[model samples]
Target: MISLPEASLLALFLETLFYGVFFTCYWLTLGILLKKYGIQRDLLLPVATLLLCIATAHLIIDFVRALEAFVLNVDTIGADAYYSNLASPLGLAKTALYVTQPTVADSVLVWRCYVLNNRSLLVGIPGCIVLLANGAIGYYIVWCLSRTVAGTSIYTTIPGLITTFYILTMLISIVCTTHDDQDMTALISWRIWRSRRSISGGSADLLPVMIVIVEGGAIYATSVLALLLAFLTGSNGEYPAMDIGPPVVGIVFCLIILQVHFCVGNNPQPHSPSKSFTNLFGEQGEQNVGYGIEQMIEETDRSV
Candidate 1:
């Protein structure tokens, strides 16, 4: 029978394998996005290129560490020795990779937020600070672990801080995408009102893109929340979460970018004068109706 630690190692190996599969999918999707959208010339191209390199190197390190601790060393060394190996300098290097991947992913999100917000310093500066702080704390935790001979429990604040970082990122993303040239909630309300008043069956091409943005943020937020909860519980369950979370974060970001490329990049035509308002709302319907009165009434009702 497989012991708990052995099972944990097996789970880590499986998670690493799954991460490899996700990384492959990321590359394929990236290729398709670049081919179709010509995003290779965009700013995201270099960032994504760097991220891919890091992911490849990180995965290679992961497999090597797993092999050293679980397979290659298992026969010669005992279980304690196996776990102890994780505190060695090489093992510290492996643990530090978890921080590296997330930091890059967070940087991507921050850059996207900056771009989406028209490079607003108000948004970008705080994000940069938070990211830097998170990286510092993560490295400190890893450095502390590296000096120890046995694996030790990390600070609870670490996970909480990570959760905060992810929340901030999600908020920035939601604001940027939803407010990109228009408000998503307002657009959806307009659509529902228009549907109630008219019989149009056509939908906007950008609607799916917006929906994907929201869904992507939700997926990433959920994953981060799960990891935070796992850490909060102080159970070994956080191990699997740590194993799978980084790649999943990368995959989510790539998927969002790809969806945007497919939907927005393919249809680069400028909207007609009459359809400009419709494009802003990202829905297909008559644009003659005024939302000003309705918005005022809602605001007035809320105040009352």
Candidate 2:
């Protein structure tokens, strides 16, 4: 029942809030990556920076659009009219940024999965195909939106494309979440199971589950799922959900890196099981963890 202007204002407010959280996490993540791997040794720093830039741009665009709607053009075009004009440059730019941010995030995720599976062609092929499809559909949605007449509801104009785009978004997130959970679980569980004879604590048994929980992509996946549902149900909730997507992507990306860095750094005993576990992520095994994580740990140990 919310009007388009109300939804736009609400979305800007929520996006600003999420952007604050993302900025904090992003800086902390940058610090850790710099201390552990520096710029030359790791690609994650650049990737993270790219994500931050995109998210910041999205936030700024939202702010500008909100200002134009509620303040600058209040007497002229009016708030509702400003927001309802989807073909405006700012509107189109916002949509393009939204599409780009998630595509980059999902690409990084798929790359991580490929690395985790030791660069297997099977994993790489399927992931690339899905990623291409995702990008194509996402941009196509943007293109469709751009061509629609002003003040028309997007859901009404191209309902099928909107639905397809969100479904693909959800599908990508779900696939990444599933692969991350399964791979992390298998690696940690196998290690703990092997070392069970030497170790005596139930706490160690929980490490696999804990690591899987921390590293899993469930948070991003859940958000996308919620967005898809909101869109499908034709609710105003989709506006805020769409607005939150960029920051959510950044937050999830940074959290995974930060978690891995601290988890490795906290247990630095020379012969600790955690060290052995970290080692398993290197080239010696068929199953690998993310390159950034492995490199961060190695560099941290060298500095110590």
Candidate 3:
């Protein structure tokens, strides 16, 4: 018989796992869009924002359905519970945050697309329309989230590794000259290419640790390798965050499918990103040991 707290913890764990898979798919989609279609950076940001907002909404709804299990007693769940839960000033604030998420994403898209991207006649005239509109809504949600729901499941939402990375990056960004996707890529490329004969030079030992940190150690080495594919291409910097979940999950799922073959050691291995260099630049590309650490690319010639 599992205790109630144990059950709750189990639920939380499952929720986290499911969300991890969820995020992974989005990340893979985003990666494909970026790689092949060359999604506009400004466009991509709002789409990310929209996906997050939608995910947040789904979370809130599920929380409502699960109130009895996670919050007040199971039998006590009722109209009173529903009404009372939102009665707290804090609860109300959180509720506001939840409601406004979609609006914020929608409004931002409108502003960026219809206003800036379109070079709307409504924008350049400088009426402060978009500024006032965005500020009002954005700040409203910030206040709501800040006030609501007693901080909620933030710990589960962002894994320790990613949360820590964001915190450190934000702190450094406050003062240091910021490096964008390009600058980081150049550094990574030079390190990996060390004349191309060897594809193992830029091993930030800490990076492989991130795989275990954000994701549990259940996945196979193949999945981990696929998760590392972008890094092999020196394009890891192009991604904003881990971007591992979906690909890792896919890798794991495939591995599960290929288990018999793997056990027998008879199946062909899946394509390796190590081959991407070879794919892009051909045979000579594989031999690209041209430079080492000092070659930070100020800009990626290709679009991000």
Candidate 4:
């Protein structure tokens, strides 16, 4: 008969299977986006590639950990040695995979915030600091986890950092949605909420992408919030959540990029107007009065 530890290991294997499916979907969608966008080379490619590598590394680490638990521990070493082995360096390395996954995922969100804000240093500084602090705290926790086995104190503190990261990410998304929407000239300007209604007529082409971005961020942020709650409550039931959270993070990021690619391909909206034309048009196109009204009209009709 399987014991509790064995059962938990089996459940973790199942969760790993689910994560594999999500990872596969990420690659497929990434390929489709690259093809659809006609992106020969872009920054996002490297970011996606890096994430893929990290996720693959995580999977490898998980597999090794499972082997240690099931084969080495259960089949050969006996329960006493098995439990002892769990506190070994390899065991802590396995646990470290979880930390690495979320950190990289959060960094990706931070990167998105930077890009969305027109690469403004001022805009991303806070997020960068928070991200670094998260990494530092996580590293400390991992070091402590490796060295000791008696206490829940370090583990409990992790949720706070995770919560802060998620809250900051949500704030970044909200700020970009509300303020940076105006900064993006390629797409029609519309706030995240009430987007479909606000962007009427031909301008509505960009609405779907906007919705995807907002919803994708919300999905990730909500998952983080749930994970934080699970950790804070100090329940063993948090296992399932802990197992699946990383994959959910990957899914949301991939979904956002895929949806944006699909919408942009279908929409084929115009590029941002040239700087001189923008200055002439202003917000109301009434600032300059009569200078480039005809050109602005031409650009608007052709683009929007």
How many clashes does each candidate structure show, in the order listed?
0, 0, 9, 0
Q: Is candidate 2 or candidate 4 better by lDDT?
A: 2
Residue lDDT tens for model 2, 117-171: 5456887688779878878887887887788787688668678877887788767
Cα lDDT tens digits for candidate 4, 44-83: 4555555556556666665666677667767776543553
lDDT per residue (tens digit) for residues 195-254 in model 3: 232334442233322222222223322232432343344432212112222223333322
Best by lDDT: 2
Q: Per TM-score, what order, best first? A: 2, 1, 4, 3
Best by TM-score: 2
Candidate 3 error regions (>4 Å): 1-28, 36-39, 42-50, 57-65, 68-71, 74-79, 114-118, 123-131, 134-304
Order by lDDT, highest first? 2, 1, 4, 3
Report the Cα lDDT for candidate 2.
Answer: 0.66
Which portions of model 4 miss their true places by more than 4 Å? 1-7, 33-40, 75-87, 150-210, 213-215, 264-304
User: What TM-score number comes out for model 3?
Assistant: 0.30
TM-score of each: 0.65, 0.80, 0.30, 0.64
lDDT of 1: 0.50
- Lowest-scoring 10 consecutive residues by lDDT in candidate 4? 178-187
Q: List the residue pairs that clash in candidate 2.
A: none
